[model samples]
Target: MGPDGVDKKILLNAFNMNSVGHICHGLWTHPRDQSADYARLDYWVKLAQTLERGKFDGLFLADVIGANDVYGASPDAALLQSVQVPINDPIVLISAMAYATRHLGFGVTANLTYERPYLLARRFSTLDHLTGGRIGWNIVTGYLDSAARAMGLTEQIRHDDRYDMADDYLDLVYKLWEGSWEDDAVVRDARNGRFTDPAKVHRIRHDGPFYQLDAIHLCEPSPQRTPVLYQAGGSPRGRAFAARHAECVFTNSLTVDLTRSIVADLRRRAVANGRAAEDIKIFSGVIVIVDRTEKAAQEKLREYQRYASPAAGLTHFCASIGVDLSRYGPDEPIEMEGTQAMVAALESITRYNPGRPWTVRRLLELMKLGARNTPIVGSPSQVADQLTAFVRETDVDGFNLMRAVTPESYEDFVDLVVPELQQRGAYKEDYAEGTLRDRLFAGRGGQLPSRHYGRRFRYGAGEWADEAVSRQAGRRGT
Candidate 1:
């Protein structure tokens, strides 16, 4: 039960990437893991079907544009470990998965830093339409310097400055998705031979330092004109950005106190921006290893650890912090400073855990599962109790379950944990009907809510702005 004594249904998203090695670095070597077949459509299709059967909320797809090359000042370690380098475009796989499942939402991460807002808006709209409004865009301003270099930049934009650029980019896309077309724009009158009423469609004009655009949306409005907006950032500036724009905020699973603080701050920031506290659903990334009994689950974890590599996890972490961990001795205390790469991640180790004095040895030991998050290993009842307490205390809406052994890890959660949570009334036994947005918000329509900052770009508001300009011009004529 929640603070209000009501059961808060836990939401789960199968957090994954279109690659062999995702969060759990070296687990791709597991015999039962089929993550290597990520290139095949059938693999994703089957995953989607399984998630639907388990009644998962969504499949959150993570993406990185370039290699993780900071460690040892090279990509060799990352390449050898298959650490997120042999990745594919996540957006292309969505339609097939959507076709296979009726209600699984796809939260795809696209770095807005390198993608043009105009084209990116159209692509999301196309997917939202194809998926019947079950599409979401995990808005990201990339942190990798390698990604910037690949996009023809010598270095990355300063950490906060990237968010600044993203702010403008979002405004331009909002104009396209929410303002360019009206609800009645499409007439589809075959007898009268008029397909659409052009007057209802308006041209959007935006001129900002980072992005400038003046065009009507290419396609007519999709079911959710703007796909469900998702953001992940825990820094002060990032929190501000998410508060203003994001409907769902992806976060890291740290200590309960730290997670609660972060969640509270996000909700407070949302309320400050004229949105309700409940508007933003928080999903923390976690790893789970479960089976029929506690002993079996512990044995499963032990078996999986044999193939895990702490060195690969360190390599991935090095790129995230923009520091080479290899320079530090095993027992030496590590000092971290601000970097263009994930500012929040660097702070997670140093700022959040004050006076803990993390060492290379401790960091490596934490990667027992070859991932940053430690696994929650237990039987169904034990895991369910822990998850319920987490939700009750942290006020987190749900979890983004990271894969330890691809299909095996996910299948375990669905069969084991889902039933236990359902029995406790902490999880949904069946999915709620409607678009992703509708299901998530329960009776709120499949569009941005009224209080959302994006809704200001809606049809009548845009038209009013144009009319006000014309009225001023008429007075000048008089």
Candidate 2:
């Protein structure tokens, strides 16, 4: 809600990962923080119930395949401080969570680099089938060279090349998910001695530079044929890819002007790509610390900082942008090589920052909370004011709220800030009924709109996609 007394509901997702220490480098030591229980399903179950109780839009789970080991050109810093190293698979925990709570969407992050499109598509379809369409995919290309090396590659692929690969990968999956079978393909008839009609299921034939496939989709059509698409790309090439495929776009920037520019550019690109201006829901990552009073919130932040591990945070950053910062002195200027892994996050320290270019020393200091996103610490009213202002300034639909601690951080936001926003007419008092996509775009149907690239392949649409896919598949080498 604006201080001027206007009505607006801010979308909120509790940004988390399946690990002890996620974004906030070393706050696992907080007395009230039970992040150590990340390995247990009960922890996630409780978290899901809490988010649903608060009427949050989703529980966004972030994941990575490899360690953050680029700061000292070694894995010591990351492993020692437990900075996102012991991460588990986020997708595996969803069923239990979905079973525990209804209407709470799960936006799980999965890198496209390591998995095959056929297997990935089937798995997501299964999840959507099980969760009743309350799922979203945060499409990402692997960023860490450590991850690449661990997976038997000599090094990670070039920046733009990765997005190119992802473009091809998504097209194949789109066909598998959206083109393979009709909604009525399953015809259970005991008298006819048949479970499914084979004629209604089409085999998807894909041939491209990076991959080739001629196969039918393994799973039946779920509630949402394709899960809601979420992307967090900030590079021009990455943005182009996202504009083509994403339904929800996530961003993180240091300043309001830069974030606003990114949002405007994304919408303009979406429009250019034939999607409507409001097609994508752009969300900026934010850290909100709220309490009964401003001073209490400030003290809470200071206490959280007492246990922070800046080295772990910087090390994570180093691996992200492909630069080792441990050797550079305070006076040195950084040359950033931002990759597909949170391009906006990498830029916050170097290229796109509104203030002075951050030196290694300064960057280490600033990343104490592992905050690549903006952090707002204040009372409920004050936090609500800043939140409304941020939305107005950036034109982003909502936020992926990063945690300063574990469930305590979220509990405080719900207890203090949620009420204030509700009073200001800036938060939902109750969640709308439907699938995740339905909840996201209320009143709109659960399926992708006709304008979306993937929808061109729905069920029996052929020649239209046949030509378009040929051109897209040719882009494998472009």
Candidate 3:
């Protein structure tokens, strides 16, 4: 039970990416680390099985389309340290992982800026079908100018402008996922010689500012018509967009007050946007380093630090905030300007904590574990106490646990911290029944909630509002 005597369970998702270096930049060099085997399907399959054994809610896969080249205006440093370059597609790894586990959910990140809604809708639906509704999408507008250049654009659109594009993209996808097929559209009737009822399958026609589509969704309705929605934008515009559409929000906070502020703001915005206060589950990114004893944990941390690369972490950070930190002196104040990457990242250093002036020296010290986020290092009890207090005080629903040493880091959490949390009634002993959305929302159902913006595009008993509008536009030759 929580301090309020409420049995509020803390959710967990193993945060990782399909690359040698993920959040912890240089830990791939650790002797026991197995992240280099990321390309192997068996690696993910086994990892999924282990997470399911630990009763984790999901495996959140982070992805990047291009190299981290903002530092020194080249990809050399990132390539040398393997800082999220040479990253494979995250979506391709999920089906195998799902097949290997019964309950663990997969939240795969995909950038909307480079993908077509019509095709992306089909891919997610197919995964939902294969995983028995254990699928989610982390919506992101690409932050890297490298990605934009690779996509044949001169540069990324303005930061807020990308969210505007995403809004239209989501609208188009919602139509394809929810409005294209009614509940009874698919039927196996040998006598009638009909596998589907044509009348029930509606054609989606969207002529939005960023995208235009005039076709039916390719696949039939999966267990969940639309996958669970997640968003990680922390800017004002990002939060507003998330409030309107996201079922879950992923956040990273350097302090409890910041996390509390974010959690409160997200709930307030969700309610303001015509959703319930509990509509969006907020998860903070965290790293935990626990051992059988407090001294042993500290020793382990020291060992991990010897193999960590602070410069590599800086290279990754430079790309994130869209500012090159290499030019700044150790104590010089780094300016936050120019690029359209993650505005929130820049604010964290330059504005969030003014008392402690941020400098290259401070950033390197924070990256002792090769990650910007500080890890909670101690015995199981100590780690559990901090984690429980964090959730209780900040109102964050759970954590997206970043990996420091791949399976070793994950295994330690499951074996040590999970049991401690479970003993305190702060973690689930077993997963609830249903799809990813249903499980996350505690058996609400395998579809988007009735009040969600996506539901507006759903094909219900009467004429969908959009269909009526589309017909009017058609008659006017629009």
Candidate 4:
């Protein structure tokens, strides 16, 4: 507790992607960085053990179905820089990691646009069952035209329409997860020779514009009927979708003021949608390098910078917001009308930091280690103070710590900063009981809460269940 005497706990999530070079472009070449071994099962297992030791809330694994070819209108730069290439499936790593650590949660990114609701529902249910309720889905809609082409489409769907499709997709999945199996559907009644009651199982019937499914959920009700819903959409339409469904939201903003505003807006939207003020926990992306003293931390950062690639960073940034920064002059400002992809993302950058607009050179500088997520290098105590103050001022629930190097970055934080944070009463000392949802939500059940739109689809629920898919379609005009 600080002067206010409020025990504010910060949720720490290890932000990583299943690739050689995830965020920090050339860090894979660092002498001690073993990121090249991402293909092996042991690498992930060791990572899981380490994070669980540090009392991290979860390990968020990012994925992309297709290559990042938007840079320079070709995939040459991306492939050469190893910028998230040779990426493997994130879901496959979860089971192995879960087997390695009992308490740590897994937030796996999955694009809802590619897979059907029924298929995706069963996969998550299986993961939830296997992880013993430690699984969470980071819902993402495909943004890359490369991904769209890979799926046999001419190009990606319109940005807002992607969210609209997700709106319908989630509605159908919710019905399958919530309405298909009654709470007590499975009964081990050997005396009566009944494994499950057929009457308790209901088929989820959905018929709408995008997809059609008329089948019961393939897997039984897992520990959590719906794995913890995590979403990372920052657009207006995205916020509305997240407000209605997401349990946790991943947020990225250039400044603290911007981040605070985004958090406030999301919470307000959630409340307006009939949820509680604290219903959605916003996790701001941050990069921290710490040591016993500020000088040591700064020295470490300098050493890491030697391996950072400014070129690759710029390449990745261009692909992210859909603007070819290489085409513009070094000092050219990125305007909204110019960007053809992730318009909402680019708008946030241009809108927030008016004094210094993001130019090609500036954007490249920001991506030296990773794009836009401001890195903080300081002594353990100083870093702790900064992080605590950030959360307090911004109303964010936690920080998603992006790794600068492999296990070393995480190891350093766990050894140094975590102790200081714990002493200051800003971080938890021990793992909490129950599912990931329960731990995050204090004592709330594993399933989505009563106010969540998903809960309305409870078995044989009101008129909404019958028309949920079509209802959302009509509302969105999709």
lDDT of each residue in 1-478, candidate 4, tens digit only: 5642435699989999999877788888889999999999999999999999999999999888888887789999889989889899999899989988999999999999898678889999999999999999999997788898999999888888888888889888888888888888899899999999999898777887787888988778888889899998887888899999899999877778888888999999999999997889899988998888999999998898888888888777777788777788989887775543666677876865578787878877777674556688999888987888888889899988988888899999999989988887778899988999999998788778888878888775654455767778899999
TM-score of 2: 0.94
lDDT tens digits, residues 174-266, model 3? 988888998899998989999999999998878889899999999999999999999999988999999999998999979899889989999
What Cα-based lDDT does every candidate model obtain? 0.90, 0.85, 0.91, 0.86
**Candidate 3: C-alpha RMSD after superposition:** 2.1
Largest TM-score belongs to which candidate?
1
Comparing 3 and 4 on lDDT, the stronger one: 3
Number of backbone-clashing residue pairs for each candidate, in the order shown: 0, 0, 0, 0
Q: Candidate order by lDDT, highest to lowest?
A: 3, 1, 4, 2
TM-score of every prediction relative to native: 0.97, 0.94, 0.97, 0.95
lDDT, candidate 3, residue 362? Answer: 91
Worst 10 residues of 1 by lDDT: 1-10
C-alpha lDDT of candidate 3 relative to the true structure: 0.91
Output the lDDT of residue 115, model 2: 89
Instruction: Give the Å shift of residue 217 in candidate 2.
Output: 0.6
Which regions of candidate 3 are displaced past 4 Å? Answer: 3-6, 461-463, 469-478
What tens digits encode model 2's per-residue C-alpha lDDT throughout 1-478?
Answer: 4453444568999999999888888888888889999999899999999888889999999988888888887888888888898889999999999999989999998888888898999999999999999999999887888888889998888778888889889889988888888889999898989989999898888897787899999998999999999988788887898889999998877778888998999999999989997889988888987889999999988888888777777877787777787778876877566554555556766677645677877777687676554479999999988888888777888988888888988998888889988887888889888899988887488988888888887875754457667878899865
The candidates, ranked best first by TM-score, are 1, 3, 4, 2
